[model samples]
Target: MAADPVVSVDAVSKVFATRAGPVHALRDVSFSVPRGHTLGLVGESGSGKSTIARLVLGLERPTTGAVRFESVDLSAAGRAARKRMRRRMQMVFQDPYSSLLPHLTVLSNVVEPLRLHGIGTVAQRRERATQMLVRVGIGAASAGFYPRQFSGGQQQRIAIARALVLEPEFLVCDEPTSSLDVSVQAQILGLLQGLQRDLGLTCLFVSHNLAVIERMATEVVVMCGGRVVESASTEELFAHPAHPYTRRLLAAVLPLEGDAPPLPADDWDPASLDDDEREVVRISPGHYLRA
Candidate 1:
């Protein structure tokens, strides 16, 4: 039998009460991240990708369904149990510059997580942080420098070091390279892939770039207006997209590819998220990264 999933989002739905009204960010969206496998979330700006990431990480509770980490329902998990779970799971946000402490040095940033979790002694945390930074190509000598002193790629490396210092089993990366320079994007992705291989990590990777998703994920979930239009192995989905929305997405990203059929003008309207039902689900308010 297949091994149990490391992370499972079971029929989860999230609605936010905004000044305008209730916005349904996720509508019965569900998927699982198998051990050592990366599940990619793909869609345009407001398709519920980031919302799913927050829900999976337990940073945000689903308005209506359950999020289970290693089969433990987060909604039902006790305070202490949830705290323990936090140490085992971590997130790599889209903007490393904003995520990392501007005032803390590189080493301090990486060591902060260890310190907060009480994972090791001062010396041990320093050693651990140094090793992680080195693994991500940051030398110990540069650890004392603040976030502004490093390049964008280097800042991201430090952010990653911070996340991995905990040695977590599950990682949630939401558009991790979206803000990096093009050449640097590949380097960072390579580092993540190598680290994931070495650590046997299960990951939930969210991105709008189809090419990146195709490279990093074994499976892909295509979301359209708060609903999963297609979920399949990377190869199968790219080779044969069953949903109309998925086809449009593939065509937009890889226009030259023959598999993505040409679109009929009336097939999809960018303005609306209606699929015969005409249900309009706006993204949650204040979620700058509109899922």
Candidate 2:
């Protein structure tokens, strides 16, 4: 039998009430994250990638449709139920500096989640936190150190440790490596990939960096104007992008030689194409495109 999806988003829509009118943030957004797989959500700023993460986390409710986890609709779940669901899902934010508390020691930071969930005794929590820190490549000797004492990459690893302390099955990584140097970014991505494999975690990776997405995602979803313009497996998406937006994003990624000119902004415009050209084309099984 096929493994059940860990998370499901069904025709969900999000709208903000503005002075001018209702501003639609997400429109008919739909997808499923299969068990132990990674799904990458890619788009420029204001494309609603973060919004989807928030919606899934119960930080915001959808204006229409539902978000379900294993057939339980998150939008309709009670507070206690939602709280319980959170133990299965956790988040790693974009900025490591902001995510970690200045006054808290690394041990405290990692144990905070356990404390909040009322899991284990104090001694057990500390031991588990220490083990987690080591698992994420931070030494146990550094547990007494503050967030400021570590480099950007180490801080991010601490953040990852904190998120993983609960042994969550699904993780929402919102630009987790966007702020790091190229080398550090690679390290963090590799660490994440390793952890996911070891723990059988499902990830929804949200980023605007197509190259990074190429490295991390098993499947890719291209978003624009709060809608999914294209979806495909990573290899198929890169090899045969069907949507004009996807093509534009792929083109924007700097070549390995680092000498290619930056892609022009006009390349992202869907309006430039006629209706016939605007439709997403299917280049292969599980690959799609939008003009």
RMSD in Å for all candidates: 6.1, 3.0
lDDT of each: 0.84, 0.88
lDDT of 1 by residue, 154-182 (tens): 98999999999999999999999999998
Question: Tens-digit lDDT track for model 2 on 180-218?
Answer: 999999999999999999999999999999998989999
What TM-score, over all chains together, does every model reach? 0.90, 0.92
Model 1 misplacement above 4 A: 254-266, 270-291
Candidate closest to the true structure, highest lDDT: 2
Candidate 2 overall Cα lDDT vs. reference?
0.88
The candidate 1 region of ten consecutive residues with least summed lDDT is: 282-291
TM-score of 2: 0.92
Off by over 4 Å in 2: 1-3, 257-283
